[model samples]
Target: MRLLHHSTSTDRPFHLDPAPLVRWVYVGRFSIATAIFVAAVLVWQDALTDTGKLLVASLAFAATLAVTAVSVVYSEFYGRALGPTFHYLQSVFDLFLVTAVVHVTGASSSQFAALYILVIATSSLLLPVGGGLLVAALGNVLYVADALWSVETPFTATVWVQLAVFAAVALGSAWLSAKLREAGKGTEAVLAHVRLQAADILYNIRSGIITVDATGRLLYANPMAEQLLGLDLDPYVGRPVLEALRRIAPELVDAVDRSMRDRVRTARAEGVISAIGRRFPIGVTTTYTEGDGRNTDRTTTAIFQDISDQKRIETLRLRAERLEGVAELSASLAHEIKNPLASIRSACEQLSRSTFTGADERTLTHLVMRESDRLSRLLTEFLDFARVRVARREPIDVAELAAGAVRLALAHPDRPADVSVVCEAPHGEFIVEGDDDLLHRALFNLLLNAVQVSSEGGEVRVEVEDASVKQLDVGPNFADGGVALSVVDTGPGIAPEIRDRLFDPFFTTKPGGSGLGLAVVHRATDVHRGHVFLDTGPTGTRFTIVLPRAARTMPRFTLGTSSATVLT
Candidate 1:
């Protein structure tokens, strides 16, 4: 079967949606008839002289009913030509009906004459500017003719006054209604423009944006979000956010819930999401908006991006940096090995001479053995620095970690008894996510350096502070959260010249140092996505490691023997 389609003019500029106008038109017609019938009843109860007025009222009601039925039929059936033409026809009929009723009752003095204003206002709203003015003029003509041809009242000064008043009301109402219609059209146009611009931006922007209501129901999502999230989101509006995102990223769903439950104003983090049977990196940021007034209606807006490409680029950049470092380290290693090999070769040659005494032979042998051990230690340090990785990450207590590191540093046989090691941390539990053994070795290196550098009887302090309350320059990336672990020592500060190479592999001031301690600390902190900061002054030197917190809160894990791995 073929279906018929009807076009509407309401889509054109300066026209309104006709559905509401049609409804109001029906209501107005019915209400006017009811008012007229009641007025006639009161006149009849008073035993009025003119029975003709009652007849006119009955006729008006019938006419109004007939017109209302015709308009409704045209709107429902024909559908076409249901615009200004229908509205103007209704206005013309109302003018004549109202005039007939007024003439039959009392032309100049009829109370029902005031109903002209209602007709004028409604007609003006429904019609265009010129069409409404035309309607008003026609109603005025009908009213004036009624007053002039009235048989019950003379056309005296009173009639002229009534005519003038009616004309003024009609014209004034028409002007006002026209202005109102223009304003409505202007508002509709502005709203349409804004909506179009908003849609354009939402679709074109690169970042994926999703807006969820207070109950975690999805309200709106742009095309970018659908593409990046790998979901057909057109039909997902009003669905639960978890229902859509659970398969792809349960962790992101949990993050959104946490933001709502905790009432956090803003949060940011990076995670891996599984979508389309593949896992990739994503960076998520949530902004919470609170509703005004007593009944709280909060909205959470989450903006995210597929960062897999960016992460791939970062990996390549880091690999390039490591390759460049390896080249430099190889040169440094060759220079270092040449000196040790030369010392050992010289010692061997001396021992091979027959003129050498027995004591001399023993000294040469001892020199060769020392140089060989030194070479072995250097190679081990290089391996440790190159192999640093954070494989198993878990939450660890800050205080216990600090304590273990300090104990290990103090327990060293070569440690000076005069130097004291202390761990200062808040009484509250502070658990941070990181590789357990890696962090321990990192902290141990910092504490050991502090102890070795401090003068006899000097104090070496390991301080752990929550970054949420304290001052640290980790930048906006970690501004939302983090903890700082710092090792401070009371000793002569590092010289400016040597400070630049403090963390350089194979560069150290100590006589027998392999110089990989600070480098290992640097690598370990980097693996946990943390930063290292160093402050050296005339008083002392301080080394700080700042690490961000994890989403899950795990119990404290004390450092056991397994945690004390030598980076070298």
Candidate 2:
């Protein structure tokens, strides 16, 4: 994986630095001066050369060197203001100077004509593509004018051929320079695009990304990191990461610090962070970036993700597996104890009826009977939790079920008279396909729980409605439609410590409670492929059961409402 820090600068293929070119101008001035002196010496020594041609050649060289010296001074003093236009102006002046010297020294045949090529080539580097070609055209025109002026009569084909040669050289230099510039631009563009793509991957990726410098200062943090850590990151950049996250996400900085100090190239850790009034389980992976295999300039990059949902699902799965094992054991144990329990109850009843027994003996027998009955009830509850079955299924009205459960709960002899229970079915009817007995049992448990939790004079409301209208997320199974049954109690909410294990068998908070009511409710709903959710707060607690609606067309299984096949 290639890691990249964010950068704001745009890439450029070529940045024309004027310093080197200006230096080159000075070097060329010196070299040309030396060449001119040598040429002047050669011309003056040759007797064949006339005085006029020698003077013109020497004067032209002197003029060219003087112009170069002036340009060097101008560029050094005010180069920023002139930019590259100074080089261009010098190229134009050199063209005219070379033309003048060539015209004086023998026009078409002057070897000094080669000087125009140098002017055109240098101009191409300082100017744009069009400007380079324009300079080439200007050089061609000057060469033609020199050729025509040098001849006293009509021009020969040789002079025209020389003009053509000069034109070709000028055009060739301009074309080659433009190609070089474009090639540089293309290379830089490719590099820029690759850099942009890398930046996008770093910024837009799903995982949280954070980079801290060698001193544990935050260098870069992506948007996901800001959200996952729940911190205002804009203010914290370039600050110490440990200090920024000290109150909420200290573990993250600690992990990064450990990775930076360790010998390992990479480190991994998991922990819970409390931020924004919530806790999140995050998995962190820290990568240590080394600089020159030394401790200096080291960087630590941490990637993290929220794993709270994953951990909760894992816990639920583990609990389900454990409950399955317990159910298997309870089924065997219940069968083993049922017969002995029955014999004990029968013997106690027989002893209580005997006339020979005194009042104390009768009282002892009654006590034995009462204790045995309590044991029987406890065993029955254990059996109910251990073995849950749905042997029959049919379309039943959920509103009717809600009404029956509410009426039964309110009429119970143990129910508090000051508590009011009400049923609401605004739609009047909703159908769900499930075993009638099992559904009834699930609703009864929920209703009973609400009534028990309610304070005196408090209301317990049982609501039956369409789950789709409420927009409850009942998972993929109930995509078409479903019915919802909720039992709400106006009582103090469940304690946070007990909420997680609220549905576990044999787990209870109340004295002498069997602890299997919610467990049985969970099993009954599971057999029908239903979902249950709890909404608990300081105000009250609401238990909602969602079961998918029955299909319009009947299924292959036979419907039965009269009998239930007990699983145990």
- What is the TM-score of each predicted model, taking all chains together? 0.64, 0.38
The 0-to-1 C-alpha lDDT of every candidate, in the order given, reads: 0.74, 0.71
* lDDT digits (tens) for residues 157-202 of candidate 2: 7667766766676677667777887786777677778878977897
Residue 472 in candidate 1, Cα distance off native in Å: 9.8
Which ranges in model 2 have alpha carbons more than 4 Å from their true place?
Answer: 1-324, 327-357, 468-474, 551-568
Best of the candidates, TM-score? 1
The ten-residue window of minimal lDDT in model 2 covers 559-568
Q: What is the lDDT of residue 171 in candidate 1?
A: 69
* Residue pairs in collision within model 2: 418-457
Q: Write the per-residue lDDT of candidate 1 for residues 1-568, one digit (tens) a residue.
A: 0001212223456655666776786787778776767777774564255567777777888888888888878787766556777787887887877786677667867777776777777776677667767776777778777877777677677656656665676667667766766787777777777766766787798988887767777777877888878987766676666667877876567657756766667767566678767888888888877877222267777788888898899899989998999999899899889999999998888777768888988888899999999899889888888889987877888779998988888899767899988899987756778789999999998888888889878999999876532332233345235677889999898887887687788888888788889989988988887778777788788887877755554222222221111111
